[model samples]
Target: MTIRTFIKTTGSVALGLFVATLVVRGEESAGKAIAVRHSSTDDTATIQVAGLEKPLVVLHITDSHVTVADELEAQYQQYSSRMDKSYGGEKEHWRTKKKALPAAHFLNLLTLAKDRNVDLIALTGDIVNNPSQSSVRFIGKALNDTGIRRLYISGNHDWHYEGMPGSDDALRKTWTQERLLSLYPGRNPLCYAVQIGGINFVAIDNSTYQVTGEQLVFYEKETARGLPTVLLLHIPIYTPANTSASASSCCGNPVWGWETDHGFAIERRERWPKSGNLKSTTDFVDRVGKTGNLIAVLAGHTHKARTEKLSDSAVQYIAQAACNGGSRLVTFAPLMRDKN
Candidate 1:
């Protein structure tokens, strides 16, 4: 079956209006970052984190789906061309209101981030259509030029070499090491944590729609540190409210068990294990719900804007695809104590 592309224009962007305002209650931790209030305009969302000493501005970007190949990696040119056309490489930009290619849509976001003096750019996943050497290098160079701090993880497409001969696990490891490791530097490409503005940002690669035992343990240890935390992953964790018919229902789709993806595997020329999600994957999801210090979960696989209330205090924010000229500005500022 041929995959079809559809662009869903969000009311926030299309109507050029400010959406709802959410009051986030602060946690009891004395010095931890706490969400106080949230407000958003067309392309920006400002979140107030209480007990913060200073404001931290972060730009959330996802699913840029950059498609390009250098001469040496001509083997992937066909795949690149296919994805470029799928995303409408020459479509008009939503933010800039100008015609741009998929790559330009990504670059334009970086320019906006820099112009806004964004402290960090949190890229959830699918930044590249494929982990081609040239495509990865292009993203790295462009980001470095902006001198903005960034954290990235792979989406399914990021490490997949369509029609490649290998198990999904082996392919991911091989291509990630060969083409995408530089972006990670000394950190573990599968899972790692960083502290920016005293808030812990833990990133995990859940592109496979499953989590490994080691990653689960890593997540447990990281969030146990008791600081305000934000969890980032390529696929959004399962939520009952996500009733979309698209394959975007990821992480732990109830029916996504063994043999459920025969059509998907064949369509993408990739492997799906006969055994569905491991017990560890479900445990990870349960752990996410119970983690007290976790403030927000940010993800991007669906390429559509969404927010799911995970718990009374925690909300998951999903960004639209960057290829569709979508980006979100999230500002964390100290809460005004007297307001509450």
Candidate 2:
């Protein structure tokens, strides 16, 4: 899990190579090359994984936060406008310096993904500001027109309606099934897996900041396939060394347990229970560290980019938000050997 991180400036773009030893539990030595390129409008990363039959290229996009309310949802116009304006900040659109809208940033990412010939589009979460009909329909059509395979899961903002009446779990389930289900694959949107280029790309909805028992079982069954797996999640799982300054906002912050939320979630009117995380949530985190074939975890939510070593076997990579015109191109390739 050791890595040497360095950034190189190439004209207007900054290139980063995260070099690491890709060691799997009960496996021989393997090294992975991760090259990340950052520019004003978009960010891209290339990851090379061993034991693949062929190279698989994927475009990872997250947190676009597009806000579109149509005639059908006139009541939500104010909310949408507020959310949309929030993205006009420098951090949200570094490429255009707030000159472009959030919707524009999303369109740019889609165009870039197509131009790159990406095999799959991995959207971890927050594709929309809420489950509004207009935003959902707009995004769905755009994705369908691409005709490319995709994996999508929910984010906290994707389902929350701000003043909606109902618990977080209830609203998430209701809106996800009623409005967002079509955007996901198969019958279940909570957790699902698809194979691409001999690799298992799994997407799970931990947008609630907690994992359910059902999700844990789904994960177990998928990993049982024993294929090289990449997990897509909205929230990054807690690491043992979770004492970073971002503890207040990150998952698995020791203080994040039920009783000590510190009223951080009060403003949303829906706080995670004071009772803390369930056994299922903690169990899921434990299993992730032990899975032998697991290669990497792709996640978002902090609206920034981060990389953490999940274990000696896997690394968790959080890509920058698409609202800022960010993207990461991940390639899974067969292990190359030198011949004398």
Candidate 3:
């Protein structure tokens, strides 16, 4: 069974199974029950939960690199699951060990998001160390447990694994687009848009390491609608400071660089240079900026918690911390007037 054939045949079977499981579980509500709680913190300190006239709150979690079923415990236990292990070619070992943490972290993330009562949960990407059928299923189950509107985009690690002869096909069959729709109904899994509370949430696949033309088109269409939009993808748009050229390889591991064939390399850097892409980013900003309603650009892939001000524009670029060690909480409110 070649990879292509396996994709055709086995994919169907696996997708069917996934769909069935989803149907059975769809009616069940998961997550901690929201309790009526009050806080005495100063008004400014508390996150305003009263929905904006058109309030849109997004909880973003990224780069979980989760390994399902504790498969990587030995490696994680050996190295203590450090995020910086790649500096000396030791990343693989540590990565293997810490793989299970992502799944656990994902559970914790969901519980936290539920507590926040966010309008939506956005998983920016790197959900698994390498895409595995079981890992994806586990992710689906976890999201269902959270019971909030959710969206998932691809990350670099997601396409790393090549499916076995029949395994690839089996997994595909079990997780088809239609099936995902049934499971996550209304919120399209693969790259689509949904209007929640007058704001447009446009999810795109940035797992391929570069932005594609299709994504740009989607952006144009969504932005043209005059609705404030939130763009979700795995990799942050590479800037000069973080390009593969400027960053040294992780010892012999090519995965850490910006231009590597696999890892974070800027495979399409020429086409999407920092300035050119900045224009693209700006174009997006301008579209929404014109409305004075664009909230923030939410992303993941770096696995570190960060918020960069799009100075010339009103948009804030937010990156969520990895779910493994700690998760970052994002509070959204009208921009403070004093900052002006």
Candidate 4:
């Protein structure tokens, strides 16, 4: 999965919603950084939302890998499970910086969104560290709390593991269009579209690490409208703007910078067998570039905030995970015109 190269394993660490309503259009955002306060950690970002009567303020929150603390003890009692749960690397930040992955932190973010009057919230994915029913419920409840409309997508970890107490069949269930839509109100498909502030917001699921042929079709139809668009997804697409494609590589890991061959593309079938490609990864990026309408491609999986010039017209925004108490406040500035 070029898009979702993360999630080698559920325990491998890394991973992390909202709604919209009023089409409050104002002026193009000047791309200014507004300070947003949280009870525990204060975070801020400068955002440019393109092509709106007014700057459409969007909050990009990702990778809130949370599970109810109480549920864990219950599971232990039932299964007598002693699975090692110590996670390092990305999880370390939550312990040190954010205190812990408490649902309260997410509630704080929703409150901030309301206070700031964000138009729409793009939940790039991964609401749980592992796929537990309780974990999914926690995220679902959070989304319901936000009065504002939101677009939610799934990440690798969301449905990657089912390792709770009940010992019958605890296999990891992959997220499907059916299951996901059922969780959310109304009919939200695996790949769906929402219109906000004159921009087409597309929520896509590339959690399998591969974009399907059907997904390509779904996006193409949405972009055919030719309105300025923002693509929301789980994994961050590697572009020359952020990743060093020319960087040297050791085996598969980047020794110098990073490689683009697999990172940027949705490879075709027969190439990758484990999770072989369904359609050309280029199908999506190429369309965005050629059409020149997609202003931004926002994703999360890296658990760090970074931006890239995906093309002359569009910029890719990779937001940090909420487990680390992070969110990207994106203000859509007016899109640069061709003038040709």
Candidate 5:
């Protein structure tokens, strides 16, 4: 059997056991429990814990690409093939092969979050293979099962090609911005703020690839509030100061230099300028730096975990690892110096 088939079979068996464990544990812990509900709120769900004052923990999970059984093996094969091709057709690949178990990896991530006692879970987007209604619903159900206050946004994959069968017009009508917003509000909320532990966490929909005029306006308002802030988005904004050739490097090699050297570009075309300019993102970062209270910018979509200190600013920009197997834990304290 192929790796794809093995993953699917193992995931199915594991899920069955997980459900059984939950049932037995629920029965044993509680005498008579009828319903199991999960938290889907985007706002901060705060709970006071011992020894930690205003402890805010955000679990960042990205790019799970969850799908049902029928599509799982095929989708895995497709992604695996693409990764191999991108790496110059070498079958003995590690990065792609090592991180193919989306379902099992997601379950492990959930278990880790529960173990850490995370206060909130923020999904940076690309939750499904495509914008199929069933896939979206499946993602929602999986997240709800985690029982953590969750926030979801759209990555480019969520609506790039419109996987649902329909005409262009019908696809437009069916997957309207409203419908997508209802499904994934964290991305479409257009710069909403959630306050946890006296710090304002701002969710910006940078999935469009570029910062829009409307988003700039929202950023201005949030900055004016002068509250300690944490910005969350699907894509990490470009920072030129920390470009090095390493796994942890933010802006070099596979990330910003994929095309010239390896025949691939990490970023999609629409979101980035062909001239290879970082002006838009830099402008936004400069504005954010002026805010003084901006703590850190958290993002995903590059699938590589990296952290870079912005030039002349205290704001740390971090990209979490892909949810397929990558993991990142972001901690925010209420009283950090406003160097950024």
Candidate 6:
């Protein structure tokens, strides 16, 4: 089947999940206007907006989950077009689901962004299913072709495999730092900050649960400048379990997914550092609280859109997928202060 047809089918399945996340969580979209329409066509239009001191249009998208050019696919595609290994049939259910999503959705989303003429695009993570060289190359070129400034981070899948053991070397081969640098330019692509249209867009590789000291240092330096900062990353920071599971859930270690969070395989995979204890979650959140200019946080991983407040000044916007023809628009309105 053609890529577009497959994603439309997957999106039909994901629509119910997307609807479940759309409760009126007060001010989650930052009091900006949002419109979603369903139709039989491109499903896009330009939105005219005003009333912000410094206005920048951002297209926030993620989790294309495109299983493009995997080593297995390279080895097996000629023999069999189907992409799953069967995993003793446990993998049976998801094989089609994976195939139903591809890098084509990213290209389609780029079309929407281009139509909207977005000033910037932030792909939160999981742009590819397994960080395959071919997938990354395709995504990078399409994104550049949009002629929009871009920012990104790697998700867990973008690095390590799901339930697969000790594949960091394999991951390194697929997601080479050079490839990482091409999309993200900095001494450390995993964490850095860039300025686009008078806002500080900070990206951190909280892809792992730990907040590395080096990342914290980068945070300090970037926030010191005191520009209105919008933090972007793969996973969310840990929040306490609320009555609603989704609200409480953030950060994917103890990894969140199809399987239960309790198991030897998953637990063994979630090892902590042997030496230095980086900042505590509270300490880091406290630092963010003090960073007066910090405004927003953007992320993806659950493959379900969500939002959770970080501090009085900051709210985290979690996206579901750009793969199933999904994208979110973020407007950084002029900084408004309480008139107390």
Query: Which candidate number would show the highest lDDT if scored against the true structure?
Result: 1
TM of each candidate vs. truth? 0.85, 0.82, 0.57, 0.66, 0.61, 0.67
Model 4 alpha-carbon miss at residue 218, Å: 1.2
TM-score of 4: 0.66
Order of models, best TM-score first: 1, 2, 6, 4, 5, 3
> On TM-score, who's better, 1 or 5?
1
Q: How close is candidate 3 to the true structure, as a TM-score?
A: 0.57
Residue-pair clashes per candidate:
0, 3, 21, 26, 0, 0
Off by over 4 Å in 5: 1-53, 69-100, 162-179, 183-187, 244-282, 311-314, 317-320, 334-340
The sequence of per-residue lDDT tens digits that candidate 6 reaches over residues 1-340 is 3322322211221211000011223432122221111111112212111223456888888777665565634643432232222111211112134333355556767887889888888988877655446666778888888889888877765654444445434444355463555667553665778888767789887665446666777787787674567798877765553235543335532334334333325323444434323444445545654454555678776666665545434556666566665667765544332232
lDDT of 1 at 184: 82
Best candidate, TM-score: 1
TM-score of 6: 0.67
lDDT of 2: 0.72
Error of 6 at 324 (Å): 2.6
Which lDDT tens digits does candidate 2 get at residues 275-297?
77778888788778766666778
- Cα deviation at 212, candidate 3, in Å, is 2.3
**Model 1 residue-pair collision total:** 0
Q: lDDT tens digits, residues 124-190, model 1?
A: 9889888888889999999889999998888888888766777678878988999999888688999
**Candidate 6: residue pairs that collide:** none
The alpha-carbon RMSD values of the candidates against the true structure, listed in the order shown, are: 8.5, 5.6, 17.4, 12.5, 16.8, 11.6
The Cα RMSD in angstroms, rounded to one decimal, for candidate 3 relative to the true structure is 17.4
Q: Candidate 4: where is the Cα deviation over 4 Å?
A: 1-51, 69-98, 162-179, 240-276, 334-340
Angstrom error of the Cα, residue 7, model 4: value is 39
lDDT of each: 0.74, 0.72, 0.45, 0.54, 0.49, 0.55
lDDT of 4 by residue, 21-140 (tens): 112125422112211111111233333333346667888888776655355436533221211142212333443464643455666678878999898777887766544455566777
Per residue, candidate 5 scores C-alpha lDDT tens digits across 1-340 of 3322322111111110000011123222211111111111121121112122565787877766554334543543433333223322212112345544555666767887889888878777666554555556666666678788876666655554433344333433344362455655544454677777665677776654445556666776774565555677776655555454433222211244223323123321222224442445445655654444454566666665555433222234343444445555555432221132
